[model samples]
Target chain A: MEKQVAIVGYAQTGYESDVDASREILVLEAAVGALRSAGISREVIDTVVTANNDYMDGRTISNMRLVEPSGAWLKDESKVEMDGAYAVLYAMMRILSGDHDVAMVIGVSQASVFPTYVPGVMTLDPTFDRERGLLNEVSAAALQARAYMDACGVTEEQIAGISVKNLRNAALNPLALRRMPVLTVDDVMSSRMLYSPIRELNAFPPSDGACSVILASSKKAAEITDCPVWIRGVGFSHDSYLTERPLDKLGSLKQAAERAYAAAGISDAKDKIDVAEVHENFAHEELMAYEALGFCGEGKGSALLESGATKINGELPVNPSGGALAANVACAAGLARIAEAALQVRGEAGSHQVKGVKTALAHGQTGLCAQENIVFILGGE
Target chain B: MESDGLQNVDMVRIPAVPVFNWSVGNFMERFFDGLKGGKFMGVKCPDCGRVYLPPRMICERCFAKNDEWVELPPEGTVESFTLAQVKVGEDGELADLEAPVLIGMVKHEGADTCLVARIEGPDPEEASVGMRVTAVLDKSAESILDILSHYVPR
Candidate 1:
């Protein structure tokens, strides 16, 4: 028999730049918010999972920073340096294994403290790539964007459509960092181009923020909230270590999506998935994800954007909560995706709410959208 | 009792230090040189028309062995980037760097890979995608660390 996992509580700090709080203070704020939201005390949490990178924090063993603030001083704590959703998935497995009943997963990134270019600098392989002075994630995405436009015949106008829609949705989200006046297709086209086919408006701004979620077993979930979102399925995959894969294909994400659909008993994703929260730090990536996640037929992702099928009022609304494209906090991105999806399922997504969001999908990508992909399926109970 | 004054002491001392010799190795050595020279470099897998930046010894996709070096153009655009206000050293010391330093990935021209580097221009707030920029190579040194230069938009 499979074990059941549910999201009992969740909390997040509004995405922003230059948070006045210290790292410990940030952790405490999110942790306390989650506990209060769940109507539970700290002692109820059986295990703790944290997501952060030592390199990002400029410290070795960065998990030590969470000891006091996260309240994991003497409990079972595990640090996942990868994506936060991956950490949440691990927490689910731990509960499924009967090792624990309640778990708290926290993800934070105080990037505002570092020099702006540090991440791009650190992303280099440090051996071969750093020497060649390679560009970071942005550049990698730009290459993919160019290749995608060439392969799909996508126009700059179509790419901007995604930005316009996301930004419009962001206007409704108080936590969104990039809410702007009504933007036009021309505005996106006219925006400063960071790479060919990618404009400044097409990417998410670097925001420093933190998010935390509380997971509980079925029984505990019943006691916690009236609207507990069930984790029907979870899947994660990693592609080839290098960025040399077919640009049009997201092999890892596809495989992970398939596994997640299978686990959730989903036969047809496009028809069943009502809402989707995808991690698209770059604009074109949103289109690529449409193909990779089986939301549309391969090579027809441009059509999905063209038809406005992914808009807030479209057949399948994507990123209704402004998404990573509006407010991107690196380590917290994946968890934010999951948290947003959970909010939709719980009917708690204010202002940016999508209608009839019964079953939602949350997807995350790491390492140039080529490796380290995760997919989670959440449903209203 | 007087003879007991001739007592002795036995002691042993051991000294150990954390090995901190972190080298960028040979493959990285060549790549960094290319950066300092204002050029981007990649290793091509002759078997499959794939080029890897921060050249890899082995191809990730085809598992093909890479032995040839290829130079890439320095011109590219920003893909995605984050500005960091904090700077951290290897020893976990936070450096008082400037408030916001632009760091992002630059897709090199005619290459399939993107390289991460520092963004240096007249105005960081003006940094955006599709803004034409060239890699300012460091001419003073020839190591991975030496590839330090800012991106100036054309």
Candidate 2:
């Protein structure tokens, strides 16, 4: 919101259940791909920001292996142990500080290397919650889902419908992992249930992925590309522990969105934004996000989905790149959302591209049941 | 980069299990002391009157030091629950449990917060929200595990 920063280029890998390449190579590919796409050499990059979780990576000082591949070897660099969207926010801030002209943000995760939900459980209060040994990410999500469905009168059928829509859209996304063009609500409902309301298909598939985006000051952006997606506004917020807050509400997302909207000078989000890329770890989360982002009234998310308004060709298409339900690689997920939105703004999102996307909103989240939320508003000049 | 199966394969199994000694400070020490006496204790915020099932050092809402400790009633109502198909071990890996378990969030009587624990006394599928439940604690216990196994429908 200070000095202007714009996303000049972005790239991401084809998300798979398991990538054959080493993480360093995967990171190098993404970092190099972005530089090539921007038609700029790494010499111009004044800083590099890497996004990853050390706990998830199973090591301390985790980015040491990735630093060189990320093109951060001799440059001013930092890391954010959160979703990639937050990493982009950090890069934008660095550019805005006038200390850096161009900053490349790279984020990655390999969910297959470990039981994906274990690290999530470790995030709970180790003194009691971990000692109790009953809750994990899936179980916590079940609690949130049940509370939300009970409050809103949402049904399992409606939750499955969300998966059907997103997975269906994924068929057109060459980079997504779960591309089921013929996936039906019945198929989704019949999937192995992880915890009651959360079925295997209803949750994000285990994926390995990396994504990169280059953020630069307005002057550097102008030199990099003719079509730069300006970072108009950004916002982020976090809620208290599971027991302290209302389980049915995504209060943090609403708070973050309000801050983002205020900074972007948008009074009516539904009319001003042309497209949106929401990060949903679970199918039910998308419905919750629709309400939290103010796209529809609270407890009316199911109705919003049923109205077919969020479809790829719908009034305000959301997750045209299929979203996390198709392929979620944790830290890489949020950056992928921003990259997909940028592609839409640049008219380069191949098969899933929306028409005339002047403004776009990208969302990212972390913690159990989306305890932390970040929103980014992007615009095309 | 083509692999010739066994010829190119080399493996090292360096499995590790980390152990840490956590300090359960004075606040949690008191709760444990209360648990050893066959009673459940919780912290009450003097300013807001909000009671935490697991005693808190400070009020989460008002940020006031919770100096008052209260005896939590054994009975409570279920707020939400899940029937877990799998369980995780101390090493943070999924362990095979013999049977599926019922977990619930129970808002203890006279407490503003809920406790997450195992549930019993009803079929997991039949464990409905708002069901009345009570803590089943074994008084002759050295650990929290023996102190409270699960909550049963009252």
Candidate 3:
């Protein structure tokens, strides 16, 4: 029989403007919370996985900060510089492979702790792209957003609707930073425009937060929680990093979602999935993701949003916990998405709960949707 | 293994093209002037079709060679854009530039490439996908970076 992997515990620090706590302290707080939630001791964790970027932290070998807090000082700890979902998936793989009975995955980013533009500046290719002083993530996404609009006819108002909805949802989430009393589509439309087509409201606030999840094998999971969210499928893919590729479509995300759906034995996600938490740092991306994830036919993703199919009370609620667009902390955004979905399946989500969420999908994307996509499928036992 | 000072330290004075000095005045003067001057120029790729705006010494895609200089058309479309609320220097020092600077990817007409530059003339909100923009070159500058700022829908 294949080894089963399940998420037993999850914890996250409330998003803040500036976390005065040290990086180690942040990790420790999350680790302790997860341990308490899982009702397990530190000894039960057989291995560790951490997701972070050195550029975000302004240090080389940034993983050094997690040694003590992650309980991996001398344990088998692997570091993934990409998204947290990648780390979570890797942890699941390790637990299923029988090399580890229990695993802990942690992701943290303190973008607000560093200089505002440092991470963006660091992302530039030092040789060529950096010389031109490209305005980091925002600029890259803007390019893709423009391309997407040009090719797909996605209106700016429709994209703004995503921000309005997510921010409105964030108002109900205690962990979100930019919650408002009332958010209207007009508010999003009138919000300060950062990039043409992408407004300040459409973009995620720079936040400092940490999130963690504990994974266990079937045997270990049985001892941890009766409502473990099983990791049925996981997929990751990367495409050409060069900007020369077509910017209109996310080819890599499509492929990764296909692989993940196949692995999960999900033939038709639209009918099978109960909830989805996609990484939409920019509002228009949520619409694009609908097509890429096969939630709807291509060019019909916006229609799904317009039809209220992805609302909290809709057929398939998306981002019930306020997505990255609400409280994104870069490295932690992907893992947070998975954790939110897992919480919904475990019936542990408070306030922003989705009814009968049995099957959930979490997606994590990096680098202007140029590629480096990860997908996960978690189902209630 | 013996340690020789010369072995670890190889000094090379490679031939280089100074693209733009890290100065707002210098960048604007060079880039804006390049656009007004009509003759569109980009750092040529001796190896392929890849072109670099604000010109680079090497091609990022292939890393093969980038020596041939070419004059390109000044027209392109707005890819995506943002209005910056703040500006800073290389050393993290704040610069005295107008807040909410409009920046975007300007894809040269009929070219397979795009560049990041200042989007001038139109309101940033009015700037949209497929909006036609041309290089507003400064006539006095010699470097390509002097003429890189993009102008309104033409």
Candidate 4:
């Protein structure tokens, strides 16, 4: 068996539309705050992994200016050009390899700094997809949404319900960017339609945010913090080309979730895991994720929404921090999910905290239609 | 401003536009060469017998080097479509078009993947799933955009 790893500390800045602060300040604040929370200084960190996108940053080597701020000064440092959850995965591998006892992962992005959808467009197949110039993140998501809705007989009202539930839940999360104290499905349905079934409120709001996670081996985790969220399992997978993969289902996410469940010895996710933090950029995807994660049978996600099983006070609460629909900062979104899931396991999630979350699942994805996926399972000591 | 926690903030505009000439690579080079000749091209994996539309050098599942290049018909069935209402401008604000364009994903016969392109030569409401469509090749086509301007119901 590989060496055990645990999350000892994490910190996140307020999710806002425009932070008006430099990227350096955003990264430093999260990293330093996480170190303080863990009761450890820079001297204790053996390695650092950072997640940032060069296209989004408008600068190459997005981590160039972040080495010092990320507490990787003179220590082994690397980067994940995708989502922040991948950075944490890399840090876990480094510690599990026994080469590093403690690792720090940081993910920071200011979505307001650049044209939000342009970066998403740049990731398309430049040879064909970009030359056509019709699809971006939202449009591609709409295409996927149309396919999923048509395949499963899911109505636009179901999609609106997800946005309403998540946005209303955001009111309880002080750090959420787009909080709605009172939101209704009717309001979400009446919002301007961006692409056929996808309404204005169904899409993720652009925001500036950053988050950090400190991982330590079991031996060091015990000494650093009394409340350690044990990293029980990890899994990641990438689907084929956008044009090639099936749009109706999250095939890659299912593969990733399966691997994670097998690793964590979770035979039944619906019964075993008490809470779930899914990085769903669009409202309809939260419903689709329930099916992909094996919480319900295929094409039954819409029925799951009506069952109210995923509510904050329901049988299994999902996205107690409101998930990415509340505030999606691109590279930072997945790490925020991890941070939220960790809090749930630690019994420190404040107002949105579930009653008793023993084991929790955190999910993240990247690329069009969530082509790349990663899943993590966290358990409390 | 202090109440919102944003005080004395200044903005700077740094203009950066990078020009890159990406290589079309070996397989794409062959595919475009066929396009230049007014022919639809796809490479067939000898092991799996699956034809890739934007022909890949190697088959993802079979792991076999695709050595057979096959000429495909220009007609396909519509897998999915959307009448996009809003478009994101360079400024990231939603922009409006005089009329929404019909976009369709057409899967060519003998091909595994759908080729996403604009649906032209038909009314937007007339478009439906599983409709047979043919690609109208441009005789003087220089790129993928020019080769097949749009797809029409066959």
Alpha carbon deviation, residue A4, candidate 3 (Å): 2.7
> Which structure is stronger by lDDT: 2 or 3?
2
DockQ of each: 0.08, 0.53, 0.16, 0.51
Query: Which ranges in model 1 have alpha carbons more than 4 Å from their true place?
Result: A1-3, B1-154
lDDT of 1: 0.77
Compose the digit string of candidate 4's lDDT tens values, residues B1-154.
1245545655556576777777878888887778778777898999989889878888888988998989988889887777888777767566876678777878899898878888887777677677899987786766556687788998
Question: Candidate 2 — which residues are off by over 4 angstroms?
Answer: A1-3, B1-15, B89-97
Preferred candidate (DockQ higher): 3 or 4: 4
Write the number of the candidate with greater TM-score, choosing between 3 and 4. 4
lDDT of 3 by residue, A1-381 (tens): 133888899898888877656677778888998999899989889998999987676677999878899888788888989878889878887876788999999999886555555566556544335655645666667677877877877888888878877877787789888786488889988986655667778877888888999999999899888888888888788775435556777778889999999889999999999999988888878888888899998877778999999988899888877799888887889999988989889888878888898999998877654467888999987
Clash pairs detected, candidate 4: none
lDDT of 3 by residue, B1-154 (tens): 1234355534333344234444434423443455565755556677676765544555656866566556678788776565665444654423334666777667786555567677788876676767788767555556444444456678
* Model 4's TM-score against the true structure: 0.95
Residue A102 accuracy (lDDT) in model 3? 92
**Interface RMSD values for the candidates, listed in order?**
14.7, 2.5, 11.1, 2.4
Runs of candidate 3 exceeding 4 Å displacement: A1-3, B1-104, B108-110, B119-128, B131-154
Total clashes for model 1: 35
lDDT of 2 at A21: 63
Give the better candidate number (1 or 3) by DockQ: 3
**Residue-wise lDDT of candidate 1 within A185-271, one digit each (tens)?**
898888765544556788778778888999999988988888888998877888864344555567788899999999999989889
